[model samples]
Target: MENSAGIVKPQYVTFRDDFSFESGRVISSVTCCYETYGKLSEDKSNAVLVCHALTGSAHAAGFHRADEQKPGWWDSMIGPGKTFDTNKYFVICSNFLGSCFGTTGPSSVDPSTGKRYGIRFPVASVKDMVKLQKRLIDHLGIEKLLAVAGGSMGGMQVLEWGATYPDMMKTLIPIATTHAITPMAIAFNSIARFSITKDPRWNKGDYYEGEFPVDGLAIARMAGHITYLSDPAFNDKFGRRYSAFEGFYDFNGFFEVENYLRYNGYKFTEVFDANTYLYVLKAMDIFDLSYGRGSLSDAVELIKADTLLISVSSDFLFPPYLTEEIYDIMKYQGKKAFWYNIQSNYGHDAFLLEFEELDRLIREFFADRGL
Candidate 1:
């Protein structure tokens, strides 16, 4: 099958000697895969690191020189004169350490046993991903970033930048995200994980030696996909529509919407590994900026960047209220901050699909700052 876009073979960098997760197992050498776009300015001030959402990879923009089939993940926003404007800024995106796309994870070979780590692989955390990203930036000779931006899981990393490396960025843009995940969010993820574990082939995450648990993973993806869209979106797109060109005994599929989700799950399984999904989701679940905070507001105060928080009005996954809270916290701390509630019916995925609004805002936001 052909890759979606801008997919580049990336270079890997090791972070810890034996990186482990909260699950208490240490694995040797966690590797991260990343890609870079444009050139670092003479002073290296034009660097912008774009993080991808859950299930996204390092391919942020530009087609690989030898492979046109795989383009960058954010090609819509990251080319020459695009919102990210690679012509003016050096854009970097990387797969987190525990991901499947060329990065070390459960699917990667265990150096000790010469077998896939599978469930034996150490768990990863959001902090670990951020720390490894900093190493990637340093390796590129970028002392600081013009901006750190992304949506969803990527936005979580952006928030971490302000909290963990506040002085490293000139500006921060976190879209469609929250300072900390909600219990509902945890419940959804827990259910998805349960779907995978309940599969007989999961075999305690040791399915590497047997058939892949595609059915379970696909069901999990189907369930989660529902949360990514708004009720209005579903009503408009599918509502009570039934399957086309098929009767009651039809085998083509169920409703058009069911077919849609099935397709989404099917295509996703082609390029994404189930084990990697388990690892990454676990990382996201453990993400909570309030861990060190007396309150969420206190957690926001830890950020040290000129920040811009954007949220989609219809996004239930990480609602606009979360963005408002972050903005309020920053303002309470007397920091330079801005926010926008972009109206969209597309819900959480709005930040990715509703590009015209996002692209315009990002370009204007940076241009006004002379970035």
Candidate 2:
């Protein structure tokens, strides 16, 4: 990357119109917290909308304040000369509808009752998230985006954007994601949800005014975090090492991995809401781009944008085969598509870590399209 995007501030916008959710439910009035780096071109054709993974905020790059210790999540791959190249593309990122990070979600107050939606919030979908994003894009007066890109759950939104609104963007980048969630992935999610629901403090998702379900939320984060890394990553980082060389017979003798996960789990509770977690996890569990479109190939046929599908070799959660099928289908249809498998022990999170390789591939893909 050439340089940073410098200190930037987040922006907020609220839409008072009714939002029809995929679950046949509706909510009136929602707000979005967003951030933008770089400037829009005169014709507004250079705008890029970047979607974030589960639990990610809208700060995709740059320092939000002068003394902040860390920049945005994708700082390495964004900015002036990175693949996203804020200098050339007006990059935007928004917290999804059911997110806790400065966006309206289960944690937000309901207009009807003046109370947090809690479990009363409608079930949100990847398609619903994309439709909300379309509103933000329209608010900015951009007719079409230069590209839509993200990883994990964010990638699900990317694919949805292509399938639901084929002419909205010029390119699609879906990294470490699947068109349809598998039974195995759903099983893990079920366990995570169970961990929360069984906690007495959860109180059927109405604990905002009482004891927060920190313990349950921590367990849920721990379960979800495991799927983000590979065994090799775990082994290399923690292995069988003891937390403090305590006795093996200590009964609670903790491994370094256990300590690590516990620390992260608790830390996550500091920033995220339990209800938001339940909602977003439910959204991911039901995400399927091919559903209601006849079949996978039929769904793919609706896309007009060029696609770049990225997968990680050790991402057993989503896996490389899922991405390969996307590539296979697009090619069989004579659609412009490219695929790359990053060989990394970091597993599904390789897309977030392997910045140099990712930049190269994205650079080439954009160049081929003369973007």
Candidate 3:
């Protein structure tokens, strides 16, 4: 990402001792990959933690190398004068646990067995991911954060941070996400995992020594790509277009939509691991801010930070109503809360593409608090 700040660097941190997962399981150690933008104040009071969604890495802004073609994922929202405004706040985006990125995950070596963790990796929750992030913040000696923000799966992490460690940050912004996964969402994830496991090449998540389960992962990605878009978006892009012939349904048949999904599906396999996908999806499905709590408002009571919840009008995977429920809960608790629905036809992926509105809303939110 060619931001005014130019290029950024990536780094990793490791805890070389036994770590406890939220599930009460133990891991020999843990490693986290992260990237930072801007400078941290001497008091460490200007820090902002930006959590990444599934399939996202630590590169939240700027180019990684001189020859890099793309900036970090949120380059537009996290640069000098941007919504995150790197000049004023030190921003951190870390690859969460159960990811295939530089973070220790299924692709990482198991210290006890000296092999890939794969399916043996302990199931981690959003809280677990937030705990690791808290460790990262402490590692940097940051006493408190100005804000914590993200979208989708990352949004869940944002919520986790707010409820689990509200004292750690001043504000939380979760966009296009829900406090808990709906049964419909869980069903989709289940099917995606099933596709991965059914592939013969998956080899029960032990395919590291052989050919990877590329086909299965691709199919999973393909199915996922559908939920990321709205009907209008699909119609606008590939309504009646054909990838093969103009108007013929021949033996070798295809449409622009099929080609697009197939291309994205196979392409994703190059960067993501199948097992990581399964593990992360499960974590999301099991995420419930009210788990063990009396009610949703009870979970909201734990959050001390200012909350900004943004929903997409066209998001079918995580509809606006789900996020509204959170807003309702926070309001009932008399907490400092704000909600916005971005009017778009891009579905759940709107958060990634709706930069203008996001930047405007977040900039104002930060400005009001003198962040």
In model 1, where is the ten-residue run with the lowest total lDDT? 1-10
Point out where model 3 deviates above 4 Å. 245-247
Local error of candidate 2 at 147, Å?
A: 0.8
Q: Give all TM-scores, in the order shown.
A: 0.92, 0.98, 0.98
Compose the digit string of candidate 2's lDDT tens values, residues 243-329: 765688897789888998899999999999999999999999888888899999999999999999999999989999999999999
Question: Ranking by lDDT, best first?
Answer: 2, 3, 1
Q: Judged by lDDT relative to the true structure, which candidate is superior, 1 or 3?
A: 3
Which 10-residue span in candidate 3 carries the lowest summed lDDT?
1-10
Which clashing pairs does model 2 show? Answer: none
User: Which has the higher TM-score value, candidate number 1 or candidate number 2?
Assistant: 2
For model 2, the superposed segments whose C-alpha errors exceed 4 Å read none
Candidate 1 yields a Cα-based lDDT of 0.82
Q: TM-score of predicted model 2? A: 0.98
